[model samples]
Target: MTPPRLTPVAERAVLVEFGTVVDAAVHAAVLALDRALGADPVPGQVEVVPAMVNLLVVFDPLVTDHAAVRAALASRLADLVPEAGQGAVHEVPVCYDGAFGRDLAAVAAQAGCSVEAVIAAHLAGEYHVAMYGFAPGYAYLTGVPEPIRLPRKPAPVRGVPAGSVIIAAGQCLVTTLTMPTGWWVIGRSPTPILTGDPARPFLFAVGDRVRFRRVGVDALAGTQSGALPAPGGA
Candidate 1:
């Protein structure tokens, strides 16, 4: 299905929805628009965020009015070509033992599988970074297998530690900061993407493909010098 017509998201932003549903075609279109905005930022463009199936264009009201910016974006939307979801595949190492994977047993039980089966299912799936939100450098990934589509906790935890790998509603998320989340926590990774530095903050971009590899806790805490590759999904 084609995306819905462009609409005003806010006073200074427009939401270009590719479709109401989450699918490969919609996701690719959103990424293409996001790439186009990045490659050739419009005069009034301030930020372009790629969500699950929508592209949000934030504009500078002082430089150009909202209507003008929206018109400009709408004009260029016709030139977009579906990206085919092509991108580098990053491998994110995760430690799934002890405190890192306190919820692993629980998740496995819910899935009616062993802990090993849970780990295998999560690691083997090819997931796409659908959107980056809910926190700094926190990526909402798609392609969680059917077996692991457990609902979030009835009550969210007061604080979930950083680097926690969580799953809910067929999506996966990695926490870069300690935040309350209703999703089930499966594991943790120390080399999380979001850094505190404003200068070098988020590492992953929208449309980046990611895969999780189960590793020992000691390996995760040890020096990552050349141990793990960069996050570009190579």
Candidate 2:
């Protein structure tokens, strides 16, 4: 495998880039480097943030310069191993009826299938938490089934409710805050995915797996206010 290119970011961070393709292999490599750094950090390393295809290593400028940090990373990269174990699998309960799934019929029409088929294809997918962005506690999940995959809408929809399960560009995400989105809102999950506590703010993390379980709208009533139960490993 080709080694990732390291670029200095400002004066306090270094970016380790593993190409620009957003696929599983590149993401695994990024995670491997992140794991290695967490186990044995370079001098002055403060935080390592993983994204789709790169890692940002932040360090204190006072303790070490960029050269020393880069050298330390080079040594560690020579023997980096990708993480092996599976992350926790969260089963999210979603209601796909009526108002909860405003875009289901549209998605079905676009996919050349029935509305039920659209929901079925979505539930069949085993999604992976690729990264977190856009908002706090909001995770970008990959692995949407090919049949139901579609690009983002040309225009953004305003005031999409929190907990809306939206999909676009072969990825899925649950809205953590009330905001506008161009993705198709296929369903809604009543479970609260964001914990307000400072110690643990989000329910899901990068590399975690997520599966959707279908439920009626009645099941969602009065269940949207508490933290989700701890996820279990697959």
Candidate 3:
């Protein structure tokens, strides 16, 4: 099959369109192309950012034009190879009690389910790390079942603590920093997704599988508000 359509986005970036929907196939294509680019470096390439259904490839215009980049990408995409066992599965521990999950009640009401049911659904989801964006180590995850997909908050909440598990845009994310967000707050995780170390700055990568685990409010009682543990443990 032909690869995603590549279109110029500004003077130095190109957007590769996989489709107008979020799914594993679309993400796979994006990852495949990204991997191919990394294996065979793109001339003048600055960075490549993956999204739900697209890949934003930025290059240095001084070294190459959009046409050249597009042609090179086309060649690369044509030879794209799928990755086997592409990403790791991380089980994120989330405290879903009322104190941590502000929108939990509302989400339950919207889905015609009880709070326990909402928690169950969220935990039952088998999600994929679609891409990382919006902030450092902020991983946008796919596979949040539609019933729990609520719209972003009417206004952004200020100072949402790190490790917050929020959902919106038909997906979810584990916050890596204490920052404002418009997404619906659902839970909190103590597992830090970001690290200062250069070798493993981010815990999850594009295509990583994420499963949510329900942690009790007591588990978060003694924890500091924003102090997060590295990548695992409840």
Candidate 4:
């Protein structure tokens, strides 16, 4: 495939959009290209940020012109290779109690199912980290089942605590910091996503697969328990 087309984002950045909607194949393509580009970056490239269906390449105008950087990206895309279905699969534990998941009843009602059913659906699928954005280390996950693909709250919540498990627009997302969000808060993760250590700032990364393991309130204590077996040998 010739891929699709590229559009200029700004003087320093350009967006390469794979498609108009989110899909696993396109997402994998974006991550594969991102890794390939990083290994042999375009001259003057600063960073590459992958989104649902676009790859934003940031370059330095001082070092190289926009035309030169864009041309390099085009050439790289032509020689793209299909990525293996390989990535670190992580098991994130979440507490679905009343205090943490206040919106559970509403969400369950909207889905025509009970609260336990809602939790079951959210925990049932293998979600992939499409991209880390909207906040530092906050992952945009794919594979949220249709039953629990609830829309964001009509009124955005303020100060949703860190480690919140939220679902919005057919995707599951987790917060790394206390922030306002429109997504329905379904549960809270015990894992701290952002660490003080820069080397391992995030618990998840682009292309990584995550499976939410349903647990009780006491399971929160096991965040550092290391009790859960590592997924995929991670």
**What TM-score against the true fold does each predicted structure earn?**
0.88, 0.91, 0.86, 0.89
Model 1, range 80-122, lDDT digits (tens) per residue?
A: 7766656667788888777667678889999999998998899
* CA deviation > 4 Å runs, candidate 3: 1-3, 83-85, 221-234
Best-matching candidate per TM-score? 2
Q: List candidate 1 segments past 4 Å from native.
A: 195-200, 222-234
Give candidate 4 regions above 4 Å deviation: 221-234
TM-score for predicted model 3 compared with the true structure = 0.86
Name the lDDT value of residue 143 in candidate 4: 88
Candidate numbers sorted by lDDT from highest down = 2, 3, 4, 1
lDDT tens digits, residue span 1-234, model 3: 345888898899999998777666777888988888877878999999878778999999999989999999989987877674578989888997655787788888988999888888888898888888877888888878878878787899787778789988678888878788898778887777875668997888787898988887667655544464332322
lDDT of 2 by residue, 63-156 (tens): 9989999999999888987774467899998988887788999999999999999999999999988888877878989899999999999999
What is the C-alpha lDDT profile of model 4 across 1-234, one tens digit per residue? 337578877678878888887776777778878888878999999999988888999989889877887799888888888585577999988988866887889999999999999998988978888888766787888888988887788888787777778998678877877778888988877787775577987887688888988778777655653332222111
Error of 2 at 16 (Å): 0.9
Per candidate, the number of residue pairs that clash is 3, 0, 0, 0
- Local distance difference test scores for all models: 0.78, 0.85, 0.81, 0.80
User: By the TM-score metric, which is better: model 1 or model 2?
Assistant: 2
